[model samples]
Target: MTRIFNFSPGPAALPEPVLKQAQQELLNFRGLGVSVMEISHRGKEFMDVAEQAEADFRDLLQLPDNYHVFFMQGGASLQFSMVPLNLLGEKSTADYLNTGNWSTAAIKEARRLCDVNVVASSEDTNFDRIPALDTWKLSKDAAYLHITGNETIGGVEFHEYPDLGTTPLVSDMSSTLLSRPLDVEKFGVIYAGAQKNLGPAGMTIVVVRDDLVGLARANTPRLLDYQVYADSGSMANTPPTFAWYLCGLVFKWIKSLGGLTAMAEINSRKAKKLYAAIDESNYFTCPVAEADRSWMNIPFTLADAGRDGEFLELAKARGLLNLKGHRSVGGMRASIYNAVPEAAVDALIEFLREFEKREA
Candidate 1:
């Protein structure tokens, strides 16, 4: 079977090795008679798988002892509600950076739970850039400061994280997590939906500092409470076993390739190549600012809107799939997550060149 290069934003692509390994083990996981999906989450076999996945992830991040990792259900959208429901102890407001679609969604959810103070926003710029750090109107007493590490749809990212003294820094790193090494100690909370850089669509990986737990308001649902996951090791409910197992395989794959440091080097090279191609070509244009461009997601527009359909159809014919941009922002987007290899980027760059030549 042949695999085409995929660029969908979420439920993106999985490493071929990981997929093959899962396929081999699907019928009878590691000599067990039943599929991992049918096994009990609390059973020793699945428990071991869950524990090792967290351990490898911690090793990848060099996570500190003070932080607890939980594999929860859904994507980071659940964390949008959980973050404010839990972190906003007695504070009336939380600070948020409005970068793009995910950031706006998080801010809207927080507003329902507490007063949301937008620290900075790039709305006036049509979300083409990150609001300069100096322009942020921060609150010293805010519960926590929130930022989307990367904007999947808009293709903007915070290349450098903000330094907030005393206040906890929170991030929705769904699109950027595990793409490179991160300073785990710099933030009180980090949550990632397990589709882009992780394994699958059904699980989310949440890393929260010890202090951030046990503070959910009395009215918060038990399942929505971070404390419950922490207390029960994310087995308070039946977890997504297959997704968790696949995530473990992915973590191992990353480790086998020499961990996040190596992964970062490869990802940087891939993104640099693609961005350089976009910048050098008059036939294409990247809408985001140079400094704020995302290494994981690259959105570019053809010279005109009329060529979009031809561009997409030709791309598909040439084995490049899902290059269509989000409907909100019309154009083309390429989500080069961890599973996407440098060769894919090279292929994309070559396609862009040929397509532009044909248009010219």
Candidate 2:
């Protein structure tokens, strides 16, 4: 009956309307006698749900006809290996931008399969800012250029995507997908874990260009092969039925709110307000650079690290939950994903002001 502004990043908060609709339909989905979770994924009813979800997703991103969308089971972490296993055809190198933790993980996975070329990295600065694109030393024949659209842990984001002329540009957009409008044609592949913006933790969405399919290595597992999933319509195995259905409902909810353009406006407004509060207050500090700060995840630090526990405790007492930052980078993180309303951000900002007064 009661819900706090839940913001624990992945498996993050979903829109309340979507949750309510799911609750209403949980027992019997749209007049069916069985729950959506109990239905057959291959059945016509589930098939229709899958098809419509893909369609709405394509509409949201305005994807071109050449792209094929696959609803896969692996999380975005799996794509770190899948990208290299499938895309690094013949070429021994792939260009990666080491912007933060996620990108570093992707690079490490790629290294196991191919020679990774880290073209640009912000690690020298402790991942506080994105390396300038012009400073990159790209390989002439790298298989694909990899980038993380948003670094959830470090709270850094790439405002503009790199222009990799001939090479395929692949991105791990796990944290920022569907938060705003994107040019689908700009990249050869885009993969996102569903938990952040899509739906639940069990599903991953992959959008790959037609030209990029059918190139998996000879030893690649059938399930791990992009072409295999493409051929079977992402039913290479029994997909996560419940997660897929919830994602479909989420897609529908997003469309009802006027699609990505409107969603972007809302996200931008919320981020700007939250960032302004952090900037104006000496009590809190956002380490990420202004130009590179993530609109989805905002990690900040209290003036005194010793007071971090108190801040989280008081914030939770006041109805703000999951404000703890990642373990690797200790502090506080406010993951304001699509489901997070503007009022939640306003409430958090007000809480920050009050907490500061009490602690000071």
Candidate 3:
């Protein structure tokens, strides 16, 4: 079998060792004689798995005692509505930073439930750079200030967290979570879809400062309330048992690899290699500003836009797959998530060189 490297954005690559471990335990998990999927979520064994997963995650992030971590369903997109439903209260005004497609989608959702204040935006600059926080005009009485830490479509990122003055800060970190170390105390809530750096698509990890819970709107559904999930330990329903188990495996895998600090170092090296290749090549160009470029997702375009199809075809033929960029941004993207080995980036660089030579 050919060794293929997957560069998909989400439902992306996972560590081979984790896959192997799951395969080994598929029939019988830890002598339970049943797959983890078949086990009861409330059973002692699964409960232990859930607890340990949260503990490892907290340890990895150094989460404070005041913070509550909930592994819930509904991707980050769900949080767009839930954020306002749970945090907006009678306060109908919230602040949002519009960076790209995802951030815009978040803003649109918030508008349905509240009066959204677009604090700052890169739309004027074609979403090529994150607007400096110093230039933002935040509302004095806003309920919460929201930002998407990494804009997957634009390949733009906020390398440093923003300060929202006195307002509570919230972030959609779907692409950047677990890619590096973060100060959990800086924000009121941080949520990420599991498909990127976490595990699979069915789970979403939400970390909320304990004090922010219980602020849900009067009509908010029980399942959409942060405090409800917090109070119930994120098992309000059956939950995605298999995805939760896989996330546990991923968290363990990350710990065995020396935690987030070491992972950050590896991530930096991988991104540098790919970005350096783009920067040095006249045939290729990455439009995002250096300070705002995403380490996990890099979007670039060829000198000859007409040859986009040719580039993808050749790349796919060479075992490098899913290099296509999002439809909103018609270019090529290389998502070097945690599971994507550095060797894969090297292989991609080699292929880029070959493609450039042939095209030139």
Q: Which pairs clash in model 2? A: none
lDDT tens digits by residue: candidate 3, 1-360: 656899999989998888999999999999989999998999999999899999999988999999999999989999999999989877989999999999999999999999999988989888999898788888878999999989887889877886655688999999999999998788999999999999999999999988789999767788999988988999889899999989999999999999999999999999999999999998999999999899999999999989999999999988899999999888899999999999999999999999999987
Poorly placed runs, candidate 1 (over 4 Å): none
- Please report, in order, the local distance difference test score of every candidate based on alpha carbons: 0.93, 0.92, 0.92
Candidate 1, poorest ten consecutive residues by summed lDDT: 157-166
Superposed Cα RMSD, model 1: 0.8
* lDDT tens readout by residue for model 1, 1-360: 799999889899999999999889889887998889988998999999999999999999999899999999968999999999899988899999999999999999988988889989999999999999999999878999999999999999877887888899999999999999999888999999999999999999999999999988898899999999999999999999899999999999999999999999999999999999999999999999999999999999989999999999998998899999999999999999999988889999999999888878
Candidate 3 Cα outliers beyond 4 Å, as residue runs: none
lDDT of 3: 0.92
lDDT of 1 at 103: 96
* Prediction 1 TM-score vs. true: 0.99
Clashes of each: 0, 0, 0
Q: Which parts of model 2 have CA positions greater than 4 angstroms off? A: none
Q: After superposition, how far is residue 70 of candidate 2 from its true place, in Å?
A: 0.6
Candidate 2 lDDT over 1-360, as tens digits, reads 678987788789999999999999999988998899898899999999999889999999999999999999879989999999998888789999999999999999888989999998999899999898889989999999999999999999988886778899999999999999998888999999999999999999999999899888889999999999889999989999899989999999999999999999999999999999999998999999999999999999998999998888888898899999999999999999999999899999999899888877
Evaluate model 3: give its TM-score: 0.98
